[model samples]
Target: MKSPSIAKQLKRDRAFVLMFAPVLLYFILFKYVPMFGIVISFMDYNLFKGITGSEWVGFKYYAQFFENRDAFVIIKNTVLLGAYKLLFGFPAPIVLALLLNELRHAIFKRFVQTVSYLPHFLSNVVVASMLIMLLSPSTGWVNRIIEGLGFPAISFLQESEWFRSIYVLSEIWQQVGWGSILYLAAITTIDPQLYEAARMDGAGRWKQTLHVTLPGIAATVVIMFILQIGHALEIGFEKVFLLSNAATYDTSDVIATYVYRVGILQGGFSYATAIDLFMGVIGFLLVYATNQLSRRLGETSLW
Candidate 1:
């Protein structure tokens, strides 16, 4: 009887199950199946011999990665890059959404939104190329403008100090508008009567926004914050790899880029895997800590 009832309930929800089938299949194929390969991190892995035939060298690769002279440099770059993006990039979208919410003219708002969101659709290769061109000390428009203003020409991409700034700004430019969409949607779901009451109580635009709008969107902000924490170390490989050169390696080489160099380029598969696995563990701990903090603050969390 219980089995039949459960089957009937599932039959009623068959459409929902069918809708989720592709997503489940995708995770299984790309995520779960690949996770099985992580075991190679503990072995002296070789592509020629494959996983099973590779020598069992438990923890050696992990030990080598920690003891490597570049370990601190790589970790520093990863933390600083990720921290800068989180501190600056995460807030830009929320601010943009708030500003867009205040726009009275629908036409103006739509135009601004379309222009802003366009960058998110662009490929990282294109973005990096554009940045390189724009920041070129000799021929770039930015340099020309600086020269016109009687300032010395600056090579932004070559300077290690400029790498994090350029990386963070490019990220903000690409994703700010797209990221704001969720906050804007959340803002719309707030009660209209609350705003009306605030207005009646002699609240001005700033007051209304601070009191009504900000609080209304706080939950969404917290959840996004938690998600950001989860990926704190996982900056996009394509953008950084393309933008970076040997000159900027001090500030620009993150764990992902290091993994690429040692793994794909140098063919140190096992050691790279160990570093990658370490990154994943640290990232998970950060996410867990953030979620716990958010919960304690009585805000929304991914958990």
Candidate 2:
């Protein structure tokens, strides 16, 4: 039998095509279209003359970025923050999902999930404000508790030493429940017969989870870990920007905020674009390397 013509195939799947149209258009308009602007990184981008008339100064901005005195500081801050997030934030959701799985009481489990997930839905602005209010040295409940316990009130936000801890803890709290949804879904796909077999072999709940549940979700965990490694340097800008100040900049300054300062605030568009493009290349390399490593170590890979 002959296959249907392209027109007939389109007609048959017209509903699905229609559903995907907006998403396709969105990426074309927003994502792919903006890629052309990367050329600005190679030019001394003049707003008046624009791309065509701008002077091409290949790698000048890239060189300038490295030569800056604060370059080391900013890069160190970015890497440390990213590392902290990966170390702490990556496993938080998995642990939460595993604990949630052990809950036999449906109503309490749902209540805990609902409460934990609430923070993820909150805007960064609100979360930042809440953090500020809660951690205030004076007139804040946290300090009040400290004072009541006979210890002096320490300024949490003002201290550079505390910045990483605050950021990582807040991130884990905000995202743990929402991130666990994926693990929960993966858990549901595990075969019930495996658990039954484990039980028949005199395995307890803990043993069954350790032997069956974890191994069953190993592929999902590996994929998620690879993706997390890929995004290690692309930390969210809004929350960091909102929470950070001059005192905490030593710990909180990252590529995104630096780009905003140089590009939008200082009008060094080419320089900022060069820095951003460098980071993009680094991110791509990290993803590629991680995917390769995962493929070699296990059966699961993004490809």
Candidate 3:
């Protein structure tokens, strides 16, 4: 009992389905297939014994994770770091796009965009190595410059307080330009006539941007915000893993790093899986809530 419009829409969506077939296959193979393995989180996972042979101990792994001394510290660190990035990194690209949109010279804008975007293509290992070299107290160029400017050289990578700052700054450097690509695209689609009308009414550049440009991209912004909420807990592991040392463990030891240590290094499969499950569930719930909030607030939602 499909409606005519529904049937017609389905017919029109055939090309989209065809285009998405490979992506669907990838999800089925890698993503959904892994869900079947989540059962180990409830079992006493043994490397010697296969998943099928593992003994079930329902909730034991979960309890272990909750009660572990390191659990709270790791969770707190992860959440705090993630929250910091969300607060600062999330809006950075939007601001960049706005500023870039204001540029009258195409050549300068293109050069700036190119320079900004280039960092995103660099490997985490390279970025970390570069940071380490730059921030080295004695031999690094940054420290040399600081010392030359009549300041004592700072051990940036070693200090606990500096860890988060370095992490956040490097992340912003790596991703801001790439992130702005989407925002710039959104800005480009805004109606030219609206800006012209604003000008005719004697609106300044700031006023036009605030009224026309921002509102035009509000939906794009909202949708991206909701998606970012979904990944709030799942911070980038590569960058942190590469940059962090024992000295900065308090601030940098996030869920992913903990998982790597416990699961991969220590072979505590059940415990790691339990932690992963907890994070995944919480992250999903947050995304859902934010999506609902977005829908309620205005004209932008994933649904």
Residue 150 in model 3: lDDT: 100
Worst 10 residues of 3 by lDDT: 2-11
| lDDT (C-alpha, whole model) for all candidates | 0.93, 0.92, 0.90
Task: Identify the runs in model 1 with alpha carbons over 4 angstroms from their true place.
Answer: 4-30, 288-303
What digit string (tens of lDDT, one per residue) describes model 2 on residues 182-262?
Answer: 999999999999999999999999999999999988888888988788879988999999999989888888889989988
Candidate 1: tens digits of C-alpha lDDT, residues 184-210? 999999999999999999999999999
Off by over 4 Å in 3: 1-29, 292-303
TM-score of each: 0.88, 0.87, 0.86
Leading candidate by lDDT: 1
> Model 1 has how many clashing residue pairs?
0
lDDT of 3 by residue, 1-62 (tens): 95569768879898998899999999999999899899999999898898989999999988
Positional deviation of residue 63's Cα in model 2 after best superposition, in angstroms: 0.7
**Which residue ranges in model 2 land beyond 4 Å of their true spot?**
1-29, 291-303
Q: Put the candidates in TM-score order, highest first.
A: 1, 2, 3
